[model samples]
Target: MTEHATRHTPPEGPPGDGDVLLVTDLSRRFGDLIAVDGVSFRVGRGETYGLLGPNGAGKTTTISMVAGLIEADAGTVTVKGHRMGPARVEPKRHIGLVPQELAIYPELTARENLTFFGRLQGMSGTTLASRVEDVLDVIGLSDRAKDPTKEFSGGMKRRLNIGIGLLHEPELLILDEPTVGVDPQSRNSILESVESLSTAGMAVLYTTHYMEEAERLCDRIGIIDSGLLQAEGTRDELIRLTGDVDHIRLDGSGDTVAAEAALLALPAVEQVDRERHTLHLAVHDAPTAIAEIVTEATSAGMRLNDVQITRPNLESVFLRLTGKALRD
Candidate 1:
């Protein structure tokens, strides 16, 4: 199929409106290793913002500091214009965190877990009970609230983990790989729940290595690597970082190896990958570059069976920035 034409627009300057959460020059260290180095970004109210990076990219360390689980060696984190720290207890009320690890007790029922957390947050009696039930319904676990968490499926356990965070209805919900290890059905359910929360005006700081999840869920995403904010914008904005390149998929025969190398030598070619009979290429300009590729293949006695060129996607953008696939 013919690739759709897309215009790449540059990222605009920071938003003029007040940000709900802001971090400036955030840094963390583990001895000589700089786990989080000078990361900075802002999340707007009612915005679904994503922090995307591979493992050990400092995503967790940054969020941990923002959530007050760890103190930053330098930098400041502000929530609703109030700075974060031990003394900022009021700001703590404005933030909720769903960590990568399940924080609930396996021995406790889902309701018990939620209630326990609610009480620790200063809730009690009927107020705590009602809130637990409310979040149970929000997480689609109202019917299973009485079941011990250990007996639940992986997806159910994940939902309950999220429920524990939402019990207090904090203004900003930070989710760290909430869908990891869950079944596809469960992952979809959790994603839908997150979307619903954003629709209800809850600002979310979502951290994940899953490109598709970020593309589907985030209003904007911040790409971090090696302790720095490499890029920040919507998926389209990030894709623009890869210049004007568009992607083309080709299936052909007759020494695919030579064809792959030859395509990479073409002017305006940015990236090329050959897997079996399928070849994926990113080029500076699709129309001209694809034509040249087809001509070269034909000259080399290759039979081209299928060709598909697509506009640059988040995956392409990610590959360009990180020099590695998202899964890698």
Candidate 2:
């Protein structure tokens, strides 16, 4: 786990006026197992915050508490200045959750599904009709709005489910891996929709184990593992915690021993590992170090076939903090 001091301290009273969701020292237990322990974070308007972790990482449980699906054993969730809970109508009204599982009725058309959910939210007449049309267009389902959901692919259905959540025009949108099991096109569409929503100033709480997704979608990320928030920050901020190094791969034919010796002499090169024809160098600043690295390798009698620099990314940060790959 990352150091605790770096974590944000919970505010003295309610969420700040600018914050949409404030989770403080949230803890949960299922019998003897502690699913979420003292996990806390805040989401601001127009900001997308991501919770990333492996399976059984308490991500769902944490979101469940935040969504008021289940009461937390301890801690508080403040949404738009109101405490959150299953029975808390006002706060719940501000939340829109797009669950991992499809919640739309397959028999209903896309527009019909949005309308039905809107009605359930107490909307009607032109207001409901206009919102439904807007959601269909946002989800890119306007052309097929009249088609029965049963005729839709898994991706289309997923998009419809998202449209249903969006229908209410909630201030806070919680998406629990909304793209899982969808086709590539649908996934991209969903991601694009999320980007637009954020740009339009909706607060989004997203949970996913996909490193690329977190990097691309989230304004900030909270890495959860074994129920605890292991780390939290922007992608670059977290990567800096892993000693801020870059990896360079040299693939070619030559005496590996001389190449390793030469790279070790460079000020930026910190470590070198040889794997057959490849020499992997852990160094600082690839862009500034590459030319020198290439020249030094050739001078040491290493014929470079290909030189590739792998920058530190969320995947590397995940490995450094959690002691496991993002997928693992």
Candidate 3:
């Protein structure tokens, strides 16, 4: 690729002000299947850009190209102003990738593992040692720094995996589904670490199938499905793309038909559907409509089990656009 097609020089100053990563019209295909179809997005320094999609939604394929592991059939990927390719060491040097799969050595102590990876990136002597210590503290494994990784809990190992990526102090950190199978506590810990990294001025590209994760961490999100980028924006912007109102789910043991009819009659309610004992309502204003809905249900002789008012969010927006949940 030509230098003009790949590199972009920022205006100058602190990171996150100008775009740190720019991907334009990137496309990749495997025989008959187009895994990533003309995908494009940007990540500013210190900002987290989430690629949200379900399994088999091309999120992995997209990131593989960005990471320079796979070449794109079309378009360009520029990292901090340098084009990404197998031979482009400078651009790759600016990226720190923590893949979905664990990349640490189970038999090595945490310190040893960090030192080895740091040395691979050309770090040495006091600098590598200090960087390893810093990474150990950052990943919350300072106390367990001497323990063999095999003895660590799943969460600790995952954290160590992340630390390995940070050893080189790359400008961009790409975390691909960092919390896949860990317990809730570990998941929260991982999210907190990511937040801290972004706060410290590291640009992050986070990919996940979890709606809550995306909502919690991403400054902006790009929703991809079936190899296509369906939508891209902030949480509120994506919700607006759905063109639907708020949602309320009522769980009760009552006359179901009457409850649906009553809620549908309310001006604030736009649509109503039933699934088992739950009444799903699409409404203009959930806060305003919920009280009336509860009143209607109680009047219908239904014993209240639960009442939930859900605002338009990433999940709802995904459902509206793709007719499937983020998990599906």
Candidate 4:
């Protein structure tokens, strides 16, 4: 895959302007299963944070608690410094959630749906009408505002789902897999919309299993697995967890065991493993280590088919920490 430019950049220091939300020791359970265990993090105003992990990793559950969809079994959830619970309407009004499932009505027009949600938040009259139009224009669906949502494409429906959340002008917006099951064009449009919103000073909590999306959009990411937070940092910071190792993939034929032993014996080699006919090696330096491995393999009568050296990335760090591939 060809590389693309990234928009995410790590902050120089702690996010200090104003914390929009703070979660402390968040925990949740369902019978014998611990869905979320002591997951704690903070989101600053206008900052875009991400929760990334494999399927069934409790990312959804943690966000659900934060959105007040479900009560946590333990720990505290505060939004804009106000504790979250069923009793706090003021805090709830400041947050908006766009769930993975489309929450728009099929029979209602896009404009009608926005008006309904806006009214529920106690907005009405010319103010509500103006806000609805503003959101439609921002989502690039102003021309379709009067059309019934049943006739809209999958992408259009997804955009309306996001528009409904923005009607309230929320202090924080939580998106749970908002781009799933959409076309590439729609996905790109949605990402651009999110970027524009963040630039307008909106705090966003994005949850997705897609690494490239997180790498492109998030300022910092927190990776979770089976209810436990495994790592939390910017993309570069997390990649640094792999140390100075550079990944090298080679395909060749020799005594696999002997080849692994020879590679490990090299001074710069940190770790080596074999799968099928391929050898995966992690080394401190790319040029010198590649030279040593190639020379040793040639001496062992092995014919290398292909060799590629790659820098440490989020995927490699995930594998090193979890002992399994992210897709596994």
The lDDT per prediction is 0.83, 0.89, 0.85, 0.83
Model 3, 71-112: lDDT tens per residue? 899978889888997667888888998999988899999999
| 1-328: candidate 4 lDDT, tens digit per residue | 0011011222234334588878877899999999998777888887888998788889899989999988999988788878887666877988998998889999999999999999999999999999999999988889999999999999999999999988898989999999999999999998988777777888889988888888888887887777777777788777764464688888988676678778888888888888977889987767767888888866766678899998776777667666667767
RMSD of 3: 6.7
Summarize candidate 1's per-residue lDDT along 1-328 as a digit string, tens digits.
Answer: 0111122122235434647788887899999999987777888878899998888889999999989888889988888877887556877888989999988899999988998889888899889988888899888899998989999988889999998888888889999999889999999999998999899888899999998899999999988776766777888777776574688888978777778888788886788888988889887668767788888766666679999988877767767776767667
Using lDDT as the measure, the top candidate is 2
User: Model 2, range 1-328, lDDT digits (tens) per residue?
Assistant: 5563345354456567779999999999999999998888999999999999888899999999999999999999999989999888889889999998999888888888898889988899999999999888878799999999999989889988898988988999999989889888889989999999999999999999888899999999998888888878898777776677889999999887898999999999999999998999998888899999999999999998998898998887878777789888
Ranking by lDDT: 2, 3, 1, 4
Worst 10-residue lDDT window, candidate 3: 1-10
Model 2 per-residue lDDT at 25: 93
State which candidate has the highest TM-score.
2
State residue 17's C-alpha deviation in candidate 3, in Å: 5.8
Error of 4 at 55 (Å): 1.5
Model 3 pairs whose backbones collide? 16-45
TM-score of every model? 0.78, 0.85, 0.79, 0.77
Please list the Cα RMSD from the true structure of every candidate, rounded to 1 decimal place: 7.5, 3.3, 6.7, 7.5
Worst 10 residues of 1 by lDDT: 1-10
After the best TM-score superposition of candidate 4, give how far the Cα of residue 152 lies from its true spot, in angstroms: 1.4
> Which pairs of residues have clashing backbones in candidate 1?
none
